[model samples]
Target chain A: MTETSGFLTSNGMAIDLTDLTIDKAHKHLKSRDFSAMELADAYLEVIEKKNPEINAYLEIYDDVKKQAQQAQEIFESKEENIVTGIPLAIKDNILIKGKQASAASKILEGYTATYTATAAHKLIEKGAVFLGRANMDEFAMGSSTETSAFGVTKNPRDLSRVPGGSSGGSAAAVAMGGALAALGSDTGGSIRQPASFCGCIGLKPTYGTVSRYGLMAMGSSLDVIGPITKTVADAEIIFKAICGKDKYDSTSISGSINAVSPKKEYIIGIPREILEIEGIDKDVKENFEASIKKFESLGFKTKEISLSNIAYALASYYILMPAEVSSNLARFDGVKYGLHKKGANLLEDYLNTRGEGFGVEARRRILLGTYVLSAGYYDAYYNKANDVRRLIADDFENVFKNVDIIITPTTPTPAFKIGEKVNDPLSMYLADIFTVTANIVGIPALSIPSGAVIREEKELPLGLQLMAPHRGEHSLFMVGSQFLGE
Target chain B: MITRTDIEKLASLARIRLSEKEKSLFPEEINSVLGYVEQIKNADASNAKALQKETVYNVMREDINPDESGVHTKDIVDEFPKKEGNYLKVKNIL
Candidate 1:
């Protein structure tokens, strides 16, 4: 057997799985340097070797070989595309027909999807292979994958630390060389935060840009299916495949909305107020400053702008996200699908099924959501949060007039050690501060690997977030590609 | 501040049976969350109603079966906790 990057291929040939991006893999597959089966086997080999320690995948799909064979046929027929043979990890919340999609909760333990999510379906149509369902926070609730019933997903960079949630598994899989790329859902920074921690490129497409037909809904207004990959170009490839209007989701807009041309010289906006926030990590701040200087050196102009309502973004999101979550997740009763428990009566059945099925974080959010939406508090909390949401949207609208993009550190700090903030929920929620406003305002945001810092003899990766106006994913892709020198 | 009584009420409304440990622990934990989110009270939302009015619109579609009838019926029916001959069996409300 030969060795490449210290990894061996199944056919006694050397292939570096760590260096393979979607584009590079497509080129290699096109040239017949290696077959699709070899690529899939290389990744599967890595998953078998590393997934036990990382806990990145909850279930490795049984049909991977079959899928690779189909991709091989496409290459033989000369009908292959960029993702024709790419092995991808899908987060647990996304559905592929007849596959178990548990959202990393016991509630959906045995539930099989009756239909495929539009995004995953698009990727499958393009001949991508499904590796498995990646682990995530239950109902996409927690900032760390610690809330998942399966297990916590540790960062590949440092085994002691968490690979940020709720798309922790997706990010970790790519970071650990287990998959070329993965699909993840972002609701309140779920995708971006984890990408930051794992140093992958995560793109939360413009809200309603990608169809959410078969996705397990968390917050209807905030959820968007996105891609986590090694490069911004890979993310763009996946985004283009999945985004468009669909009859199933009425919120999905037509393709013309995102058809804007790229600008010659883009102006970037930096929110100065973010630096004033408490608990801003020193490395994160220094890395952000260096990123700004790097952008300036690349001939892009930077302006100090203000998002006045941004300070209220995290607070507003807590109220609004849970409010939608309580309503969206109410469908998980025992009478339908998922886990069921016998009790004295119908009410007890729901109570037992939901109570025992949902983890502590899910229960907390449900209670918090119920409290805010209940009588006597609805006007004060729920209604007020909506008002603040409108103001945040307005703040974005006002800022986009002055600049083409807004930049921030994806998280306040790099990946924290697992179990470090589990007991303290508020501190865990603080991890989402910089990444939430994009969701709050329904804009597209991308997290690119900015730099890293040494922590406890391990170099932990950090990310910089770039947000654009609604349907302005073009700007994000343009700047992101330039920033990463891709 | 959230009290134990409020937590009980919320748990009941949410249809979650909290254990004694949760009942003891949730008050402080939830209070911390609510206390942190309490900062939203400072936002000047006088124009919030106007902003809300601007974005509200009904999305309507022609009522037609997008897929073949019964294409997903069997799969959905197979998942029922209690089922009888294509019918979902549930506890009698009465």
Candidate 2:
């Protein structure tokens, strides 16, 4: 894929991965053309300069210099890894060994993971430097990261609006030059939504694709940890390193993923229904339709497809997510660990700790999860919701037979003002309408930064989400590369 | 038909306290939110179940090998409101 002509092709210190793909970056580093420290220093300098404007990171690791020093040693040692010395941000929910894994909640504030997550550990082995932890929605809830306990993560494109939730900080961190790439957990659109809102590339892998061993669970059935970066190629690089079987996470497919994306690819699927959403922004629609024409011009075939069961995705997602949350969150009972409060009795202490520790949106979700998963309502709601979950999965099973890849608008509208839909749960659910269907049906989806929407003379990047069936992520990369040209 | 009563009970179950205004607001908020769940109250999913875990009943491998991973009890408990000796001291249970 070649560079888009209209894009700002400035060669600067904040050069995105797409400018010089990870392969070029590594090839230069390996051949002693540019020292690893120079690349690390270039990214660190930008983050130091611009992070104050975006607030994408809660904290930047001070040990980055020491890690960079180690990367030089590995280069001198001539160790083999695809991304030796490249910097990446670990979304706070995914543990980075000793780093504070806050999940943007007060409860785990300052708490450190004794052991590293499987994915983080893998990257460390591959010689990737830990830039820092990115912020997210408290326990991966809400759409806009305004729900973060520490503070809201703003859209890099527009300061007034929000970066999308659960992985907003990760998306914005990369968008504003805080890090080269990041890892974010996507359960019910957490990764892809924020990527769209903040104008970065975020991949939500198929359900069993990535390990969830270290992530603070928001919804177990739906959660799959994945990459958020400045381009589709970078996403594929990170995904390759962290994916495959893990004994620690039973849900993670304990198998192998492609060592590299195959060159040959097939036609892309453009679901017609997604473009017809009532509130789909005109710019998003125009850009997506134009992108389709661009794909056609680039020798790719397009088809009108429908998976009507996607309509019920919100219902299935809310039900299954909460049910999983109800079970996963049971561990934080103020006894074994997490935040505790002063009280005269055990029960009161539990109440106060949860009250003070959890943010508003977390409380709302816990209550919602409890309401649906409660014993009396289980059969009437949760049980039936599971039944629909099956239908949603089948819908995908049927669709993959006809298309090689799926395409849709990553978000219905561009990033909204911080408080626009905070109070309205229905609108918030609708925010993930296009993204969540992939999670419900367990398919790999990527939200690629198409181009910015310059509204009122200000620019906000809109995303186009591409999905491939389970383990078919390569198809998206091959097709996406045609548009996100170098 | 969620009510203030329902919100209060739900809050109690969740072990949190809502203000009078919040308590009053939640029932309507929750009811309307739950109204969306009605979309999947019933649907055909004959195919999805085919992919579920093969074994149905408690697939628990007998924890004969009690998880050897040493979780520092004090490491977790020390992060509490108050501690007495070794354990986290808390309010009454009932």
- RMSD list, candidates in order: 1.9, 4.1
Q: Estimate, for each residue in A1-486, the C-alpha lDDT of model 1 and write its tens digit.
A: 012455444545577776677888899889887888888888888889889999999999999999999999999999988889899999999999989999999999989998899999999998999999999999898888999999899899899999999999999999999888999999999999999999899999999999999999999999999999999999999888889998889888786645656788899999978988999999899999999999999999999999888999999899989999999989999788999988889999999999999999999999989988989889889899988999989888999999999999999999999999999999999999999999989999999999999999999898999999888888999999999999
Candidate 2 chain A, run of 10 with poorest lDDT: A1-10
User: For residues A375-467, what per-residue lDDT tens digits would candidate 2 score against the true structure?
Assistant: 788887887777777777777777878878878888888888888898887788788888888887778888887877876676777888888
Proportion of native contacts found in each model?
0.86, 0.55
- A220: Cα error in model 2, Å: 0.4
TM-score of each predicted structure versus truth: 0.97, 0.90
Q: Quote model 1's iRMS.
A: 1.1
lDDT of 1: 0.91
On TM-score, the candidate that comes out on top is 1
TM-score of chain B of each: 0.86, 0.61
DockQ of each candidate relative to the true complex: 0.81, 0.49
